[model samples]
Target chain A: MSDIPADLRYTKSHEWVRTEEDGSLTIGITAHAQELLGDLVFVETPEIGAVFAPGDDCTVVESVKAASDVYCPVSGEVTEINEALEDSPQIINEDAYGAGWLFKLQPSDAPEMDELMDADAYQAHVDEEDH
Target chain B: MGNKTPLYAAHVEFDGKMVDFGGWDMPLHYGSQVDEHHVVRQDAGMFDVSHMTVVDLRGAGAKAFLSNLLANDIARLKDAGKAMYSCMLQDDGGVIDDLIVYYMTDDWYRMVVNAATRVKDMAWINKQSAAFDVEVTERPELAMIAVQGPSARERAVPLLPEDLREPSSALKPFFAAENGEWFVGRTGYTGEDGFEVVMPEASAASFWKALFDAGVKPCGLGARDTLRLEAGMNLYGSDMDETISPLEAGLNWTVAWEPAERDFIGRKAIEAQKAEGKARKFVGLILQGRGVIRNHQAVNVGDETGEVTSGGFSPTLQASIAFARVPATIGDECTVDIRGKGVPAKVVRPPFVRNGKSCID
Candidate 1:
């Protein structure tokens, strides 16, 4: 089974959002998402200060197999991007939820968090995909 | 789910990520494909290649039959255990399949063909062999393992039966030797010093375990593809197929035109194409941008457009590379369509990396 932390919220497309104490939100792909992509070789993170609507393709992650787009789970402006991934994308494969976080976003509507799937729902979604 | 190879259970036991490939459940990678590719280049690695079909042709008319069946002349394999890489062609000069034929004896020749083309290849060979009095027998009970790298032989030889070790070690590239039930051939797709051992299916699992214990990392199809591409080897279905002729697929050298009296299956069409000089050029491309190139990408060359047959990130070269078919008038530079944008690329002679080193500047 893939790691699905109960504290994090997720989208059907596999992006995870962690609400920060300061009202900002941190976003990254789920461990299940990284597992399917295999080892990541390259990452093109969204630009800091860029605005994105919910479900927008905000980043790109490439593996040895193929390239994939990372969707934004909620409408927000990118406050900070993970610059470390520019040098070593494998960090995402190593720690998908921690240092591998893609970006920090200041949400336009904090209520959108309720729209995302909780840990149990996301696990069920991943299980459905496997079957 | 698909048909399983003899090593299916072994792959799962080794934590291989299994995927469906050409109707077979095969490992795509153990962990990291890039790591597996480097292991074959810098050290030793092994792959379960039992999904490939092995056909044995035995009869007095075997040699005569192959001469007509394959584009390359099997008569060139005069010495016993010598092998020849050839294309089985259709009458129109299009490739049926690219295969390696080994001459084991006066009346026995062995062939290994792509896994995906098994059904059609068997039917075609059977149809052609009816008139030659040759018996075409599919060897489904055989399992093949390719151990490759600079140190591959050094690591693999110790595991073989006592008497077979010496001969297997002394085997030259493109040559094979029989020891008991094992047919050990000194050939590999990774452009490294190695052996492709064909043995009985029942013993495959144990042999794989032994090789793993000997420090030979188990590789998967993912690495196999990258290694072969880096070595500039053409893939059967991707590089050439029923619609693509060997002449346009960088395999003209494999065709034998000597002994003018010899008429192979596709000789007439190939001869006509050679005379016309309208054949498209096949060349290698090195991407000058950050994105990965993929199959069927449009290649804009001069005024005409072409297609990329195979394309991926070369873990060896640390750059994106591809094989493309373009107009004969194409020059040193071209643009490949990555997504919607055109990415510039430099054209170069293939065998991009050979002997674990980059062949390009």
Candidate 2:
């Protein structure tokens, strides 16, 4: 039972999105996602200016045990990435939603946010997956 | 929810993330696998390895039976309490299981084998013993815990049974000493100075608690794997199996080819394979570019392709290292197919680290 901030929206694939004042969308793996992946050894972030459709594999999180893919939840162009994760992927294990944000996207579709699940719905989804 | 070890409750108490390993509910990590790995390298850490099979053999023909059963020569262990690592092979020259056997006396020997291979190994052992007078007994009532690292001996010595404490503290490598039902060995898979203690199952929880109180970190299979991979030790099902030979699994040195008249199982087949000069060789791969190496990845040397037998990230080296079985003609360089792209990697001799130091240049 990790913290699920009500203000953020999430995808069933476990990506959390926070809307910024500039209309850009910040994205990262959920805390539950990080917990399941164990301690990370490396993180491969999507490059800036790369275009992606919703549900595209945008990031690769390599833990000591296994590697996992983080899918992009919305159609957008990558605007920024958390470069600090390049050398210190442990940040994702420490603060999954804060300092561990993977990338930021300049949205190409406004309705994608509405299509995503709310925090409560995402929590239920995680619970269902766990069971 | 599966087969539970004596330390199952302890693992749950310590917040271990349990996973199903070969039908046994075991811990993958207590918290962070990397942290546990470093602890084992720099200080002392303990792992509950009780799931591995332990068996006791006793009879007049025990010595002769083992010499014929294992790939490695058992006659080499003449001294009492000497231990040897060996592979049990099928009649067709394929590995049945990799195990460690200890000679306690002329008529008695103890063997510890992999958990996943227990059923098949026991069947083979029992079936083979019908011709000999040996009695094969599985010791399921025992629990094994490995205390490993530079300071493992010092920390564990104080807690041993009083009469055996001094001798266990001074035990030499690849040797074992027994006190009643407790057996302590100076051998490990982590490439470190350590003690592997086997005691009654009823006492496992208390012993684990005592070690924990002495500042020994409780590690899980996750750290155990990374540590052993760095040490160049092979896992049973991954590195070799019933379909693979020791000659192709980087275990050629474990085979005792001398004493030509001593015929062991699979000797003729391996000798035949050796004479052909077409046997693949196992080596270590260090990733030169981005991304980590994983088991079953394709390794390309020129046009020849081999397979990664076991692979993972090395916390000690801060790089990805793997055991790959490649063609005999593989050069110093090869490309590993990671994901869908070809990634370059350097081939080195196995064992990327030993005794807390990096073995690679």
Candidate 3:
């Protein structure tokens, strides 16, 4: 299984959202998603301050061969965007969880994190997909 | 069951993104395909090409057999270790597969065919060899690696065993030197100077790791496709398959017509079509605007309409380019239908990029 930090909550769409102590959540794609997509050439992230409903299409990740849509896992307002990706889109491929984080959001409901997959459950989900 | 190459485990070790390509578990890329593309164009990179089958044809009639089997004449291989690129065709002039025939001796010739076409090619070769008493042996004991780029030869030459160093280093383009069981040929699919080395399967892992340590980046099929397309080389299934003729796929140059009496299998049908004129012609296109051109995109040339056979962003050119099969009579201007809208394009000869530079102004 890929390295899944216990502090982060993950979505089935292969995105990880880490809830910071200040009640903000930092989001990015998971290692499995980046590995499957190969090298990322372009990424279209959601705008800062944009409010999104859970399951809404919020971003796009395009590799050399295919394109994938990144969905919002929880209803939240995007507060910040990773401007670093504009010049170094490959940072996402290199470090999907940290420096490659896509956006920071002010969650409409902090309790929503309970609905996301825990580290162990997410690992099991990824492992079950290996077959 | 399909066979896996010796580098299969190594690919997983590198955590390469795997895909089922032509039936083999092959790496699509290690991490970033764009980076890998730049690695080859600017520096050095290697690909696990062992999935490609290397078969040896031997017998007194080996030359005669190939001369009849392939569209190109093998009798021209006067010197041993010389290689000839040819297209094998069906009786109806349809492409069976395109391959390289290496002349090792008067009685021994080595043929390397695409990975996907191995079974059909083996069966066909065996059938044809029966008439000439030739023996067809697939060499699965070997693994193949393609080290490519401007700096490829420099990096790969020093990694060779001492016995192979001198002769292999002195080998010319399209020539190979066989030292014991090791075969080093100055060849590659990417449009760059490099070597395609075939060595014993057992030693492949160590050699691959050494090349990696020498700074030869590990690339996968993704970079290979873009590199070949930018170089104007055709992919077997996408450009032409069992139903497509080489004439329509821009491979007419590979067919030899001399020895008028020595008819290869596909000659008659091709000759008949050559007389009547073929309908479609393969040509390269440069996107005139911002959109990325892609395969299956429709081409609009007045009353003529065709589809893109292959298309991608050319890293070297920094512009989208494509190959399309359109009406043979179409001119230098056309539009590619992308997402319901037509995008203007200019027709051009391929090699969109060469040696890490733009092929166009």
Top TM-score model: 2
Candidate 1 per-residue lDDT, tens place, B1-361, comes to: 7999899999999999999999999999998898999999999999999999999999999999999999999999999999999999999999999999999998999999999999999999999999997999999999999999988999999988777799998899999998648889999999899999999999899989999899999999999999999899999999999998899999989999998889999999999998999659999999997777888999998778999999998988988899999898888999999878899999998989998999999
Question: Per-candidate TM-score, first chain only?
Answer: 0.98, 0.98, 0.96
Q: Rank the candidates by DockQ, best first.
A: 2, 1, 3
What candidate 2 gets wrong by more than 4 Å, as runs, is none
Counting clashing residue pairs in each candidate, in order, gives: 0, 0, 1
Q: What TM-score against the true fold does each predicted structure earn?
A: 0.97, 0.99, 0.85
Higher-ranked by TM-score: 1 or 2: 2
The per-prediction i-RMS, to one decimal, reads 1.2, 0.8, 2.5
Per-residue lDDT tens digits of candidate 3, residues B241-272? 87887898898888888878888989999988
Each model's C-alpha lDDT?
0.93, 0.93, 0.88
**Which of the two, 1 or 3, has more DockQ?**
1
A1-131 per-residue lDDT for model 3 (tens digits): 56788888998889899989898889999988887777676677888889998888897776678667888888899999998886566798888989999999899987788899998998888988886
Better of 1 and 3 by lDDT: 1
Candidates ranked by TM-score, best first? Answer: 2, 1, 3
* Candidate 1 pairs with clashing backbones: none
Report the error of model 2 at residue B70, Å: 0.7
